[model samples]
Target: MYQKNPNLYLKNQVMSASPNKLIEMLLEGGIKNIRLGILALEKEQLVKASEYLLKAQDIVSELRYSINTEIDSEIPQQLIQLYDFMYSQLVIGNIDQDIKVLQEVQKLLTELLETWKEISVAG
Candidate 1:
């Protein structure tokens, strides 16, 4: 349902939206920032990468509880697993590992976003 118009769901749930919706938006934004951070890091902008990555992690952490409730159960579980992998990569400071985890996170979120879009359009 959400494969066609992700903007609908994303726009409908910005931070100004209800708490539950806000969490969902934060999750999407955080994932986006993570990707941005990786790109920044690739460009050797360590400081920028650190700033963005930290913010993304912070947002995700803040919404941990709410996300568990508002996100699709399967999605959250996959995110949890990915988060663990990401955190490990962060600790290990492995560029390859980070890239792999980032790819997985992006893929997962992209799928969910698409699903939301499909649902919005169908409804």
Candidate 2:
């Protein structure tokens, strides 16, 4: 069996990706993890849910911190706050094992992904 290293593949993709692509990747990752976390919470798998949610928190935190504040506008601050809320929700939902909280995060991430898709198409 020939197995490819997913980490190496992902690293190459990231190294070659444009800024927009990177953001899309992060959003997609966050959404995927949130979806997994939701399923884990629904099944009462607190440990697995916590693990997935923590990964989501990390991705969201990265997205939040990676925002370009140099672009003069209120958008950066707004995005920071949104990401902050999502990050906190991940924590709260993990501790409480709340499926709804995870679902909310999933919805937000999906919306972000949709916007990025549109941007990519228009750009």
Candidate 3:
């Protein structure tokens, strides 16, 4: 969808993203991909779904480690809670519901990115 409907990814909005903000955006993008993968699985496209989900897992894994090293994160403490919830739901969610969650996650990351941009601009 991203390649086909670049608009769905909001390319212009993402292009304006700063470097640090970009990382969070990538994490959100990963979540979105994971949900899409689940949708693919529901549609019985196992190979495609696995591919997307693997990509998503790889992205989150990278970001999770990067956060540990790069930032003094009180956020991780919170993210652990969210991660647990997301994991639990991952096991339980149908494809449609997972996609909904992914969309929400994307919106949240976009907000975080914008907040960081605001701080940088202010400073």
Best by lDDT: 2
How accurate locally, in lDDT, is each candidate? 0.62, 0.91, 0.61
Report how far residue 41 has shifted in candidate 3, in Å.
Answer: 1.2
**Superposed Cα deviation of residue 30, candidate 2 (Å):** 0.2
Model 1 weakest 10-residue run by lDDT: 88-97
Ranking by TM-score: 2, 1, 3
C-alpha-based local distance difference test score of model 2: 0.91
TM per candidate comes to 0.56, 0.92, 0.49
Each model's total of backbone clashes: 10, 0, 0
TM-score of 1: 0.56
The prediction achieving the highest TM-score against the true structure is 2
The candidate with the higher lDDT, 2 or 3, is 2
